[model samples]
Target chain A: MTLFDYIADRWDRLALQSWLHVSEVVQSTLLAAVLGVLIGVAVYRSPVGSAVATGLASTILTIPSFALLGLLIPVFGLGPTPAVVALVLYALLPITRNTIVGLAGVDPAVTDAAKGIGMGRLAVLTRVELRLAWPAILAGMRVATQMLMGIAVIAAYAKGPGLGGEVFSGLTRAGSANATNQALAGTLGVVVLALLLEGVYFFIARFTVSRGIRG
Target chain B: MSDVDVTGLSSEPGLKRADRVRLLAQPLAVLVVVGAVLVWAFARETDEIEAESIQAGVLLTKTWEHLLITVVVTAIVVGVAVPLGAMLTRRWAKPVAPVFLGIANIGQAAPALGVLVLFFLWTGWEGLWAAALPIAFYSLLPVLRNTIVGIQSVDPSLVDAARGIGMSPRSVLLRVEMPLALPMVLAGIRTSLVLAVGTATLAFFVNGGGLGELVDTGYKLNRPAVLVVGAVLAVGLALVVDWLGALAEQLLGPKGLG
Candidate 1:
């Protein structure tokens, strides 16, 4: 049978796998964004806190994905819990860094004026600083989404829900007839998902960034 | 001046001793712990598998294989990407740069494993080149982009001055542009080096020998100790490479620039 034929045969299963991948990515991305932004906010006031936060996030990148999953396996067992945890950890650096950057880029003069007008610190942050920094924060989210998309494939190593299982099994069984097709579908799903997420991010940027800034 | 500016200005460039200790000590502690674990695993494993001389050499073989892929991939990526990036920045070739970059973006967008798997399936074989080729493809983007950005960001006045001093266009590019671009280009290479180190472990999946074999065996045999050791070594190697890269970047950059 042709590759498409095999794909057609496996459509339901593939769709379910694709859904799992997307859901996990969404769950992990949201969690990372919330946690990252909070951490960024907490640390943005102090240079030491900022440096430590950034340093810690970046250090997470040094761990190999394969080994990370393997290490987690003993503790978390074979499932999405460990997979999501790893994804969140990997996603933290970009989002946190971006949040810090965005918040930092807010003009001190603007905040001063807001303060002069009797706006409280919390009010200034919510109404002005974060508003101004929204674009950069969103950019970070976009990057995190893209990265997590690629990483979600590795999540399948821990049997986390995703299209990676198909890819992994097909890869190991490359000598078989339909193995390439299976792998192709899985890989194609991943790439397509990445592109689609990127498109969503573009649309988001267009609508969300202040019109003056866009100009 | 505002209170914030006053406070910020009060801190000297020289880090406090406490800050220095915190900066160096934390990562060093992690390294020490990781090292202790690996040594323990190696010693224990030796006692368990003493009969197999080849088995004993797993550490040596894996490290060697890991280095081979890292070196070959880094060489190929640097060789191709640096020149291609330079070529793209030329006046006539500027328009085509994005097209090439877009292609690179797609390569990066795809999972590294997916790229490797494709290459392996296409070649119907697995070994050094089979793995290295795809990794090079995946890693080419950062260096290429950095080189272009670096060249373009070179001070126009400096180029004009070179011309003013009777340097040929070729000389201007060779002497002025490249030297100035060195830091950014090196930064890009550093990024790729870290990437190559992490990705090289995946080489085991494609039948390319590396420390990943130890990882895989450890996983399959339920030996968490070996798995942890294999992983720590790979990660440790990445950190070491990153440090070395930073050193190179600092030293290789134009003297006054740093």
Candidate 2:
């Protein structure tokens, strides 16, 4: 059978699971973003400390995910939890780097005015610095979300959830066209997911920055 | 005289340098501390595992092989990507650059394992070209995007001035614009190189080369030593590339003329 015919034949069976998998993957991204923000904020507060934290988080990125999963098996063990954690560790660098860069990129003149007007430190950060850094911080989130979407599938390699199962299954069967079709389909799903998430975050970024800043 | 003329006093450059040095110390110390801890932990693990000849060779030879494969693939990638990128940057070629880069981003988003599997089937792991195929494509997008951006971002007036001086378009591009655009292009190369190194290790799944041998061996047999050794070597490769890229950028100078 032709590749399209093969995929068409399997579509009914694959549809429900793909939908469920995409939902779980979406949830995973949200969880990662919330956790990542906490990590980013913690790292940003201290001057010397942020550098050390940034290095450590980035070094974590270099470690192979499978190896990390194996290492973590002793602690978190075999499921979405470990997978999400691994994805989060990998996601931290782009998010935190951008946060630091964005916060630092704020205009010093605006910061001076805020301080001169007797705003508290927290007020300066929330009302002034963060507002200016919104676009950059959003850009960072866009990158992180895109990265995690692909990674979530690879998390499937360790037997976690999402479309990677199809891809991995295809590899095991040794040249079956059905398997090949499935793998390609799953990969397409991931690309679509990535683009959708990117568009959403981009729109949100525009809204946030526009509303937060005067001009 | 009584006002002390504070505005005329120069700031201390030495003190400024000292303060910068102090600011950098904590991060350097943290990196050293982390490296030492990782080494100690791995050493302890290695001691627990009985070493064999293959394992012994894996520690040294595999790393060298992985590095070799990584360099070869990256060189091939740069060779193809630079010309393609340059061609895509021309005004007439503008619309098509995104099509190429979009395909590249898809290539990137596709997990390395998936590509390796697909390539393995498409070309039965029987030759070097099979391994090079996916890696070269995977590294293309950043190089291509950076080249287009780098070239297009060049000061238009500078190109005009070179033209005004009667330099050939080729000479202007080669001597004037290319040098000016080199830093951004190099930045893309740096990213591509580090990524190729990490991704090349995934080639172990298809028995392609070097450090991935350790990665595969460790995973299949549950040997942490091989895995750690492989991973450490991979990371060390990235660090070396990063440092080398930094050195190249510095030597090339902020001017990019070098």
Candidate 3:
């Protein structure tokens, strides 16, 4: 088949709404990103929490993704829960590190000034620091999102949803060539998602920085 | 440099070693608490595979073979990626760099296991090249990107000065740009090396030689001891690689560290 035919075939899967695989990928990504961001923010607010989370995330990053999924299965059971948990674990390092680094990057002077003007702690954080830190923080999110996009495909081992199903099915069928199409499709889908997410982050990061401070 | 001068330049807080330990304070304590809890959780599991009869001597030989594989793959990755990255950063490389980068990203995203499976089937699973090809693919992006960035980030003035001194382009690159880019390039090498080590663990799943045998064994039998041993060794290796990178940065001195 021509390359256009291949792309057209994949794009058509997106149109059908019958592509349970695409939906699974989106769901897994959203779940992982949201959880990662929330946990990342929590770690940012507390030093003890940051240290513990960093160590845990460091340890998790060391674990092979499939093996981690295998370990998660008995505890979380088959399907999205285990996979989501694994993705979230995989994502923590980038997001949490970025959150901490971004927050730390915010100038102490600016925060003190806001507080001097009687801004509350949360107000100072939200208005002054977070605004300034948004670009770096977004960069972190971009990294995590991209990393998660790639890893979600591997979550198929746990019977979790995604294009991994096609790849795995192709493998099991013993048609390595046939598997290539699925693997290729899955890879293309991930790259598209990564580029889109990175582009969005750049747009948002630029906007946030322009609005928050002078260059 | 005198110890006092070094101490003045270091941005770390002026705490003695004893004070640093003491100030480990609550964060260190919390880490210990969380670690203990995780150990308990992992230990609670009972069902697992019976221990395999692979002798310790055999396991050691296998580990040595795996390390050799990792080193060879890493060297090949660096050999290709560093030069390629330098070439990509040149004015002429603009068109091709993005394409290479896109391919690298896809390689990073796609499951290497699938790639390994495909290669094994295609090449009849004949030799170590089956494992090396996928790993070299994995190592490419970091090594390449870092090389480009590191070279590009070199102070323009340094390059100009080297040129003004009538040095050839090659000598300028080696003496000026590379020295400046060494730390960043080293960081990329470190990332690829650690990644190679981790990915090599997956090699065992494909019956390629490596410490992955232990990890795969643990996975198959659900044996926590073996799993723990495998996981710990893998993590330790990663940490050691990272430390080695840090050491390299330090040894290259302040200019490279920057």
The candidate that wins on DockQ is 1
Interface DockQ of candidate 1: 0.35
Q: How much is A6 displaced in model 1, in angstroms?
A: 3.3
Model 2 chain A, TM-score vs. native: 0.85
Give one digit per residue, the lDDT tens place, for model 1 in A1-215: 78789989999999999898988997898899999999989988777787777666766765667767777887898889989999998888777777776788788998999999999989998888877877877777777778788778887877889988888988889888888888888888999988888788789888887766674
Q: What is the C-alpha DockQ of each candidate? A: 0.35, 0.23, 0.29
RMSD of 2: 8.0
- Candidate 3 chain A TM-score vs. reference chain A: 0.81
Clashes in model 3: which pairs? B49-B221
Q: Which CAPRI category fits model 2?
A: acceptable
Model 1 lDDT, full chain set: 0.78
True contacts kept of 1: 0.36
For residues B180-201, write the lDDT of model 2, one tens digit per residue.
8787677677667766766666
TM agreement with the true structure for every prediction: 0.91, 0.82, 0.76
By summed lDDT, the worst window of 10 consecutive residues in model 3 chain B runs over B1-10
| Two-way lDDT contest, 1 vs 2, winner | 1
Off by over 4 Å in 3: A1-59, A199-210, A213-215, B1-49, B53-55, B89-99, B109-111, B114-127, B213-229, B252-258
